[model samples]
Target: MRTASPPRALVIVVVVLAALLGSAYALGRSLVDGVPEAAPSGGPLTAEQPTAPSTGPSASPDPYQQWPAEDGPYGARSTTGDARVALTFDDGPDPYYTPQALAALRAYGVTATFCLVGENAQAHPDLVRAIVADGHTLCNHSWNHDVLLGGRSRQTIQTDLLRTNQAIRAAVPDARIAYFRQPGGAWTYPVVSVSHELGMMPLHWTVDPSDWRAPGAATIAARVTAGTGPGSIVLMHDSGGNRQGTVDALYRILPDLASRFHVTALPPEL
Candidate 1:
């Protein structure tokens, strides 16, 4: 005999229950898979996390940024960008005249910048020390005062500037040579660019008295005082020959310059 089939109502109830169970299973799987995993302990921060802002002192401003940019010969700086006047002496650190210059500066309570030659700095480290000791700014004037330094190859110019800087630092151990002045004011693009690469400002002058010619003290003094105005970088010399006139002229120039304008050395940390 054949077996009897199940009732229709029972079959329908069983089918409905099986369908509900399958739907429930799918919903649960989706819920579990959609959740994101947590980051590991002590791991790097995730995108949702942000770093805190710093609370210490802000970085110092670049002094050169405020300077006026030159049009030709590669952006050399001539002015001090303010009412202050800068007195820069070139080819210096001579044993005889440097002392006199320093004495005059000391007497007037004024400081100036010294653009030194490599050989001179090397030979007279004591004078370099004195320049630093007097709190004057330092500049690299090239090795041996080569007027044709800017016309040479880039590497040659860079090497010469670096060697001069090295000689300067050897004397003071912590000299801050912030400027490079080409000898004879013979500035070129290569020299200026190399100076920037070496972390120095290419310095020029506004007022030149031709004091390097050993002009009489009265003449040097008259020219400097008359030519100088606000933001002037007066070019004078302390070495390269007898600088007695330049030294003596300082006695007259400093008093008048100090009285008229705010005279100061170029910043050592440009």
Candidate 2:
């Protein structure tokens, strides 16, 4: 139940935009494709400052002994920096509602991540392209809506994930899909391990508004407003159900959150 992409890939004229929300802390580092950053409140390991030159080569071996990525402030480094937050959408590219959601995001000047399903991406590559064009990040959800970790072989899960990656990359060659959100946010240790080895990190949302259940607009707004804080990842949906409520709530929430705080996107833990 998806549309085939036209022979000519749509040339995306993405307008540069994201919702301009407040930031609890300044950006210390950018997002590493798939790796999520530590929230501001938690204690994190940061980079070591340069020490003065010693007599001969410093007594220490390669100081970068640790997997620098998991420790880097920018790449994979973790550090106790400033407070930050990111708004992310899942199960999207809904022909009707996704664009509305994107418009809301654009209106507020906040960038977000769209965890795309393979079939959805194939059906609506233009929207995916627009997400990238507008400067938002693209991440893989799965090839289908199936729970990849459970009731399946490792090869099955890998096939589903990799196929989605290929689909996204084919649609938007520039799409840097380093993040993977398991279907239903469900994942086994093996799934996470394989994902990391595959150059992606598992993503977990800190705040889930549960808009999929069609919660009232006011309630959704309240949850989004309350859940939002430093280093908080908010989860909302644009499809898989009646998303009109989601769209409406997003419009209202944007200005309200903007008046009180900086409605920014997540890329760094700065």
Candidate 3:
């Protein structure tokens, strides 16, 4: 098509517009195609499934490390400089046998720690007062004998411990509870932490006589006598089933324990 050529300025303007359009297209292409890259298959941008916290017994801390050292040993008996050992009775304040246990301790001029069940303490406030009157220390043993209490949550453990402490205070308003014993010796961090916050030492026994099994008075006495030593915390039961054997064993065991070790209750503060 032979037609008159356009003006040079017009031609220049057209060329300039075409160049600008091409530059814009290039920028748009770069923006669309030049993102650094997609993250690799396992990169952080990938969606991840959440994991649940462990709730099994295996998740628990080492029994010895669960509690702070200032609070006391978690798995072993408390260390003391003196030649003193603690005689501790659990699940107590029984109307029938507690009196006998108390009498035996008194006769020997020995003091012991009584880890009382909250319900029993509530039921036998007189016995609870009697325990304190006898110069024995007090320990909270939970509302009931919950062997699995260690596996519970912090809030649940706290509630259980607080209720027991409340029950104990209800019995003896001015009682000084020095220790907390997990039922069946099933201590966990949550239980220990709760007890520490509540101003009670987590008590673990060095000697267990298996008195709760009613394994004859002689057997109980033998176990206690054999197991006791300086700084030993001997575990016995005054209630939570037939504890007559325990009461009888105490009479036989105390004379020997008193002579061998300066048997006494755990001090109020320690």
For all predicted structures, in order, the TM-scores are 0.74, 0.67, 0.73
lDDT of each: 0.90, 0.71, 0.83
Decide which is better by lDDT, 1 or 2: 1
Off by over 4 Å in 3: 1-67, 70-82
Candidate 2: tens digits of C-alpha lDDT, residues 190-226: 5665566567756777678889899888889989998
Question: What tens-digit string does per-residue lDDT give for candidate 3 at 176-228?
Answer: 89888899877766777788888888888778888999999999999989877
Residue 172 shift from truth in candidate 1, angstroms: 0.9
lDDT of 1 by residue, 111-178 (tens): 99999999999999999999999999999999999999999999999999999999999999988999
- Of candidate 3, the 10-residue stretch with the lowest lDDT total is 71-80
Give the worst 10-residue stretch by lDDT in candidate 2: 13-22
Cα error of candidate 3 at position 59, Å: 18
Decreasing TM-score order of the candidates = 1, 3, 2
**All candidates in order of lDDT, best leading:** 1, 3, 2
Instruction: Give lDDT: candidate 1, residue 130.
Output: 94
